[model samples]
Target: MTLLPEFITENGEHIRLMLVDYFPRLVTAIVILIVGIYAIRVIKRIVQKIMVQRQFEPTLSKFLADIMIWALRILLFVVFISKLGVETSAFVAILGAGGLAIGLSLQGSMSNFAGGMLIIVFKPFRVGDTIEAQGVIGTVSEIQIFVTKLTTGNNQTIFIPNGALSNNTIINYSMAGTRRADLLFAVAYDADLKRTKEIIQSVLTSNNKVLKNPEPAVVVNDLTDNSVRLAIRPWATNADYGTMVSEVLESIKLELMQAGIETQPFVKESSKK
Candidate 1:
């Protein structure tokens, strides 16, 4: 590139020189754009590789990979524009002002994004983990930037916002090796406690899915009105919860009734309000 000096005619002999010419400036701008895009792509790949090595959650890994790439790209884009003779000071000032306004307006959304990021980073639950969160009980299918997906036992898909999950308590059932099924079925107070225990033991043994290693326990947990509240606490795998809940209910109801033991009323109504 060469610089040429030109004089303004009919004016007071003032001379001006343009350095580096126009073509070289254009080339420099183009190179900056290329390098910025390439750098972001390379950084994204590196992040993805690191995440894979760390065994991060699959859903989260992809999200992080994409976010990293986009963030770098946006920064590079701003730099590229600045290099291309754009007045970045004023542009950046305007962007900052607009960003603050948007942040205030979408405060809740930002919170959810932060929550989702926490979930991804800390990983309280993962795919296939049965968890109770935001008052919904289901298996986590996927965890994303904005929401966590759940598949209910009935095969219903539920999308829960990330903000609500972080704020509320989350019951992760799969964290422990074994879970106790604290089933409370009250028998009439007059019924023989010994006979009821025997009947429950038999029912538990009959179910093949019940684990024998932990040893199931049948004991009187509480004494309710008109009944003896017996809790059938059994240890089972997370996968066994659904089957246990259903099988225990059916088997206990039938076996207890056959043994002439009456079940207690869940909600007994009185004449008065």
Candidate 2:
């Protein structure tokens, strides 16, 4: 018991010496970690401000700023751990292995994350932009890190994977201030082309939503087996596209009927091949 007591006294002294030697390093590391975290936040905000000044997409800017912060924090943590005398190379290797495991387990998720980054960087489309993608035409409500939300014309909400959206072709209809409304009308083969053109042109001109700058066009598009197809194209503001097109179609039909234009039996018996 006396020997045990003596041994304990010596071991306790050694323990005290170890603490005296390591305590400063521990405190230094903790201080650096806290300071580094604060610095990272400041840097992130600075980056975000710069991006905003550059007119970068808001979603992309914020996402990239967060990535920058997390990456810096990770690097700072490694430095702090190294300052405490931990082998950084082995720690990095372990981190790499863990990351690889996570990556494998969440391959789809990683793909989405990477795709989201690409979208935010390239900015093919933006939130609130009307887009046609993946067989759905809708207004983009939000651009998230993993998915994009769309509000369809029918008021249905669609959640599209960022991976798919990045890979697919997105038609950004709202990118341009104005959109061309293309209307196709099938008329009787015997219909007077001159009269039809005049009628449609008059209707297009009367609609206040149609822009006169680019000018509306009514042309004989194609002579199909059943009828002569007339293409009526008018330019309108993005917000007025859907309503203007619907109004134009209805107005044209009413005008043609009032002018004694016949739509049924488009190909007369004598005109059919």
Candidate 3:
């Protein structure tokens, strides 16, 4: 009983001595950790504000901000562990090994991450731009870290993976401030070419959306045996492209009909196919 009491008393004294020696360091580490967290938050906010002001991509900005916060937090953790007398090099080594294992296991995720980074850096297209890729045509709604969102003309939502998107051919239709609307209309072979051109020119000139500087082009695209193919090309801003095309097409059809211009009838020839 006496031996037990003596052992307990000695151990208690040793623990008290250790606490007295370590208490200041523990307190200091905690205080530093708290301050460091606040600093990191402030820094993150500043970075976000800068990104917003610079008109950076929202996804890229958020992703970079998160990375910055994590890096700072990791550094603060290392400092805290050092204050607690833990071996930081060993901890870092362990983290590296674990990260390698995770990286190998999630290889696809890493590829997507890399693809997303490449997209952000290269800037193939931006949100609100109309792009055709992977057999889908739509306007870009968002560029996320792992995927890109598209809103189609019919209001369909599409999610494309970043890796596949980066690898495939992306046709951006809105890169040019103005888009050329190419329209083809088939008229009867006997129709007067001069009168047809005049009517088409009238229709194009009256439309405000069509750019007058480049001048509208109405030319013979092809000489089909059954009909005369007229190609109509007009330049309009991206926003007005769809509406202007519809209007031009409708006006041409109505004007041609009113002038008694005949449309080519279906004449299936054996050599046509």
Candidate 4:
């Protein structure tokens, strides 16, 4: 069969197109897209594996992995769209607008994310630790994206927003291996200072849970108008602090009472330091 002349323009340009032009291009594009998606998935898996293998602090690792995945996907999408000869400037403009809207809506969440990053980097405390923050005392249960979870001594679970945590003062009691337990008592002027000191020492010494290295201390700190002020200080492990201190104080009061050493009344009487 004889072929007809190609379509010609007045400018002396001619065009001859293949019958498979549109379909072949479409198929090629589909294949590329498929391969690209597969690559992205593979990369994501690799990232996840690396993060897991490193055993990074879970909260921090997850955050980093998420950022990696997001950046990868966005870049891939942009590249694919550009391959189709699409106007990327318009795409970016639209994305910018959408991102702005989303950001406005999620400002608080983003603040929390920033806070979480700060916390992970600084490492003021970790999960399962005891801390006092924002005037709340609790054991850290979990550190998450938006908030930190804490379980109080009373078994009450509380969720503190990460931003607030980052801003507030945090006291990590667990960070210190030993904590001082300070107790005060008053005695009458007639009470023997020597006997009182001995009693306090006996009480702290009997508490085996208290740390021995610091050597529990007892001293006559002050003498008030009503009674002689005495101080008892002991060192105990952070874990056993509350129970040990409470028990020691209770024991001393009871022991002194049993020894016929009545607590000096807070009456208007002179005290001997």
Candidate 5:
């Protein structure tokens, strides 16, 4: 019984010593964790505001904010653990190894993620922009973290991986705000070339959609064995390009027919001969 009391007294003294040494550290760790969390929230809000003010893409902005938040949280956790008198070097090494393994396992996805980051940062194209890349021509509908969605003219949806898209050539038609319509018309070899050119030019110039500054051009592009190919090039706003081409072709055909100009390929005329 005397030995039992002595043992209890020794344990109580050891417990008191441990509490004296670690209680402050525990309180400090908790305080750091709480403060770190609050700071992270404030930083996130500030970053979001800055991105908004800079007109950053919504998808990119949110993605970047999340990345920053998680990175800060990891650092805070490390600090909290260290403050509690726990060794962190081994923990950090393990994290590094795990990250490497994950990265190696998802090499392709990581490449895509990096590509997406580049795209979001540089902004070669944006949503609603008409772009031709990876052999697909369509308007960008959405830009996600790993893939970009495009909507074709026929309402088809295409999802292109950001990795390939970033590396490939991207032709942005809508960026120029204007597009040139290249139309070809074949006329009989016997037809008056000068008169045909004048008719085509008139049809283009009469259209309100055609831009006046560049001036519509009607040139003899090629002389084939049977017919003369006339190239009519016109500049029009992107919005008017399709409609202008249709209207111009119809007008040119009607005008040439009224003038008795034959549009039949010379093969027919040669056959008749």
Candidate 6:
């Protein structure tokens, strides 16, 4: 019965020593973690602000900011673990091995990530630009870390992998600011070619959307057995191109009809048989 009190006292002393030795380390690690997290947030906000002031692409800015935050978080974790007396070299080696394994498993994804970095840096096309790539024509809606999203004219959304996008030919329609619309109208073979050309030219010039600098052109494109194909070329800003084409086509049809010019549809030699 005398030994029981001594045993309890020894155990209590051991626990007190353990707490005295480890509690401060624990508290210090937690404080460091809290402060580090707050610092990371502040740094991220500052980086974002700097990028914005420098006119960086929003997608690129956000991506870079996230990468910086994650890297800092990883560094802070290493510090935190080291403070708890855990060996960092082994942990870092394990992390490296795991990263290598993940990288090997996601070769395609890594390629896409590289391509995305290339895009963010080179900036061949920006968000809201109309581009034709990989047999898809649409306005770029978003540029993500792995893919670029497009909104088509028909209101369809497409996700294109960045790896293929960077490697492929990209026709950026919006970059030129102005687009030449090639419109073809067929009229009867016996129609007054001069009057038809004049009518088409008049229709193009009357539209406010058309650029006067380039000057609209109406040329005889081809002569079919049944009709003469008139090619009308008009330069308009990208935003106005679609509307101008539709309006000019309708106007030309009306003007030709009023002038007693008969419009004809082109018939292929095989179809004529």
Best by TM-score: 5
Error of 2 at 226 (Å): 5.1
The 10-residue segment of model 6 with minimum total lDDT is 264-273
Give a tens-digit lDDT track for model 2, residues 1-273: 699888878799887899999999999999999999889888887898899887776776777787788889889989999879898998899989998999899999889888888887788888889998888888999888889899998899999999999999989998888988766788988888899899999999999999998999988878888788887888899888778887888898899899988764432111100
- Residues 81-176, model 5: lDDT tens digits: 999999999999999999999999999998888888888788898898888999888889988989999999889999999999999898888888
Instruction: For each candidate, give its TM-score against the true structure.
Output: 0.76, 0.83, 0.88, 0.78, 0.89, 0.81
TM-score of 5: 0.89
Better of 4 and 6 by TM-score: 6
Q: Which scores greater on lDDT, model 2 or model 5?
A: 5
Give the better candidate number (1 or 2) by lDDT: 2
Which of 2 and 4 is ahead in TM-score?
2
Q: Clashes in model 5: which pairs?
A: none
The CA lDDT of each predicted structure is 0.78, 0.84, 0.87, 0.78, 0.87, 0.87
**Model 1 spans with C-alpha error above 4 angstroms:** 1-30, 55-63, 81-87, 257-273
After the best TM-score superposition of candidate 4, give how far the Cα of residue 240 lies from its true spot, in angstroms.
Answer: 1.3
Model 3 lDDT per residue over 29-137, tens place: 9999999999999999999999888777899889989999998999999999898888899999998999999999988977888878887878889999999988898
Relative to the true structure, candidate 5 has a C-alpha RMSD (angstroms) of: 5.3
Which stretches in model 2 have alpha-carbon errors above 4 Å? 1-27, 55-62, 265-273
lDDT of 6 by residue, 1-273 (tens): 889888878798887898999999999999999999999999999999998887667876887898899999999999999998888999899999999999999999989988888887788998999999999899999999899999999899999999999999988998888988877788997898998888888888899998998888888789887789877888889899888877887888899899999998642221000
How well does model 1 score by local distance difference test? 0.78
lDDT score, residue 187, model 3?
92
Worst 10 residues of 2 by lDDT: 264-273
The TM-score, computed over Cα atoms with residue i paired to residue i, of candidate 3 is: 0.88
Q: Which window of 10 residues has the lowest lDDT sum in candidate 3?
A: 264-273
lDDT by residue for model 1 (50-100), tens: 998877877778877876777777677678777777778887788799989
